[model samples]
Target: MTEKDFVPKKYSEIIEQGTVSWQAPSNIALVKYWGKKEHQIPANPSVSFTLKNCRTITKLDFSKKDGQEDFEFEVFFEGNKKEDFKPKIRTFFERIVQYSPFLKDYQFEIHSENTFPHSSGIASSASGMSALALCVMSLEKKLNPEMSEDFFRKKASFLARLGSGSACRSIEGDLVVWGKHKEIKDSSDLFGVNYADEVHDNFKNFQDTILLVDKGRKEVSSSVGHNLMHGHSFAEARFAQANDNLAKLKPIFAEGDLTKFIEIVESEALTLHSMMMSSRPYFMLMKPNTLEIIIKIWGFRKQTGLPVSFTLDAGANVHVLYPEKDKVKIFEFIKNELVAYCENGHYICDSVGSGAKQLSEEN
Candidate 1:
């Protein structure tokens, strides 16, 4: 992909250099999306809660370009250069330049950092990519002042999906659905739509405390894991099961049925890992402590009639989910039993968030 491929119908000239900053949160999938089609299309629909604290804040300092050119950007994380992140950003820009032509009209100096550790395996790409996408969308909206907020967010979600399939989910608040589910109105394989209004208030503010079993990068990247599902015997069955779970979840979410919700959420987590274990060239991303934490969560739920459950991302970290009412009870359990399973006795306390925010304009 190159600048030649991007030809917007109306291109605006840059008036002056400015900066745009946006912060977007990572999300935990309730019904996981494990596979993908081309151009970052999800193979199965998934639902997620936009997290409150685990997020990425990206500031893009823009300058008018010398002449017609593709995007030329440098990225930094925590005040240090992150050249490794540039290639993906470049590719993402190339893929979405048609939607956000302002990107090619300026050179960008991007600085990004996360509230939670990136190595914690919680899909920082979802947050980071979404933040960058939001920044681009903000610039485009500035240039095209007539565009509606819905169009801006929709384009941002669409652009973010081009970078990471899960990133689309980060563009919306609270409960969100991604992929083309028959029953879900406005659902699309291209981006995600907010599902907060469709569900009961019980799910709107659920807590997700992440237990970092391994604060290290996974041996297999999520892309490689998704690729493995292509020839797996269980791929078709797994996709169908996800659809079934999603179908069941809609009523449960609306009615606030915690028991059934726990059952589905836990099963989806295990099902995700199960796919990895059953893949053609099998590999494991879960650490020994990951299982220990899961067992403990199950035992605690049984001993106490708490509405607590656990879910895992594509890594070793365990997201211990529970209602806001169960905060004290669940944290006590975490401190007493689960912290020992953590790598450095660490975790992140987060909850359902309100979604991305844009900073004040800077000229």
Candidate 2:
């Protein structure tokens, strides 16, 4: 559906006060999107594996405020007031106030917490913003009881994208694609679409073990990295390559070609960093331990002839991807050889998950 279709009509019911809570999961892009356009649109299509354990639980309490001209909200993280987070939330509200018109009419208390460390290479913004968007949509559902389930999900995803581009992928299950690609049916730059193609049994329960190489704030934010792509020498070529790889992944996924999957997934991960390093005033997000971990993974995979591989987000952390069958051996391998590379030996074990969940609703 087009963006215009998400615009809500006048509320049929007046709801004075209520609370909505939602849980949204983080996602790892198999085909990474490194650049973006205006309004959080991806420059290249990306597909992600929705994660189960790394998630954010958000609770929003709303009450009608008398004669409030601007949106009113307080942000909290893990029960602690986070004044620093309000600007971002305000920007998000400004971006989405058009579609969720009721936002300004209510004063909201947003309390959120995450299962994983924030800004540690995992997509915390993705899960966080998506949970918030879903909570807001739940409020909308109360006002418009007749809203279709499909439209609700799509609009929630659309709203999530405005907050964090990858967040659109967090609203759905095992597989999701964002950014329009010719080969992907119904794909849109406006929001993520569930990957409906034939997915083989090999990927049904795929695993991702995230090794935290560094838990520090990113030196260069993702927005800066994405903006650098505007005049990047290799920007066009990289964008084309991402689309080509996505198309290639479709057939590989359907056929259960683990070998081809590894090739593409790992390549996509490295290529993402390559773009970062290649941008003018180049920067390197990968730490020494990050490279060491990648090397160890390669050695272990080749030594055991296991279908094990690695992928990275924009930071120093590494996400080890493998099929369920190899999980036992891979997990053992990680603990023995790779855990040494993680900061303070901290890491998280997660797998493919089925979208967001609504925890509670109260009026």
Candidate 3:
């Protein structure tokens, strides 16, 4: 047979039957996914992009040794070995096996590395778990070639959610919406859709710039923050506000109108944080410098009457979104005003990019 007509007959031969590796970039939510009702499953659906620079690369090797199944996992945070991350690693693997019962008998060694600082509020969970999910799905494909890519992605996302809530969104494309369906417990309902599906057609020219004001680890985890809000006196009101924001933002995003998108996003972010503030043991993620930078950005916007807007996750970093072409002006203003307040603060600029894809035969 000619080279053009030749094709591998076995999955093992085509897949190299060895180590499988996958890498995915971190994502910052334009519409944040805060608070989860069922095991941190997000109160309202959210959308985010797959970042380019900040990413996680994961490699998995499966081999039978001494007729026993062995699992080894390691996580490196910014090039340093992280001993404290072991529990989370173990938990992730267990969840993976639980979802894919066929993987329980294999001997696996998994290694993961992150490109950015662990505590920089760069959505490390988004990249790390997404990479893990991709790696697991690749291994499954090698084991059973008949399995479809869509099946693997959906199952892998369900597995990844057991590790981190935001991880589910990372499995899909540039803009991913998670927790849209109410039946989140049903693994079948947790699937993701590509950003280009006309779901967010309205705000196409958006770009995100993350200003790292403080890289210190957050005092309150999303889980903890959510629990605090649940018990807060304003819980009912906050939930209502989230519902209203979600409904309003959908049409605004569909319309692709930057003005309406900015107004709703900024307001939603503030409202989400207000619930956190009203918790019995009040706390604030924003530092003095964080507020200063935000104020300066708002002041600049006021002067220029720009449609730029800012939002924050459950951390101190600030995410500013504006039209891609207007980035230069935004960058200059942010740098000048934020320098005094943030000694170690740095900025990362990114636009929406394609979602997870196989990199090599190994992946």
The numbered model that scores best in lDDT is: 2
lDDT of each: 0.87, 0.93, 0.66
Predicted structure 3: lDDT: 0.66
lDDT-wise, the better of 1 and 2 is 2
State the lDDT of candidate 1 residue by residue for 238-274, as single tens digits.
9999999998999998899999999999999999999
Q: Tell me the lDDT of model 2 at 32.
A: 94
Least lDDT summed over 10 consecutive residues: which range in candidate 1?
1-10
- The TM-score ranking, best first, is 2, 1, 3
Q: Compared with the true structure, what per-residue lDDT tens digits does model 2 show for residues 228-317?
A: 999899999999999999999999989999989999999999999999999998999999999999899888878888999999988889
The candidate scoring highest on TM-score is 2
Clashes of each: 0, 0, 1
How does model 2 score by TM-score?
0.98
**Candidate 1 deviation (Cα RMSD):** 2.7
Full-model lDDT, candidate 1: 0.87
Which residue pairs of candidate 2 clash?
A: none
For 106-139, candidate 3 gives per-residue lDDT tens digits of 5566677776756665668777888877877777
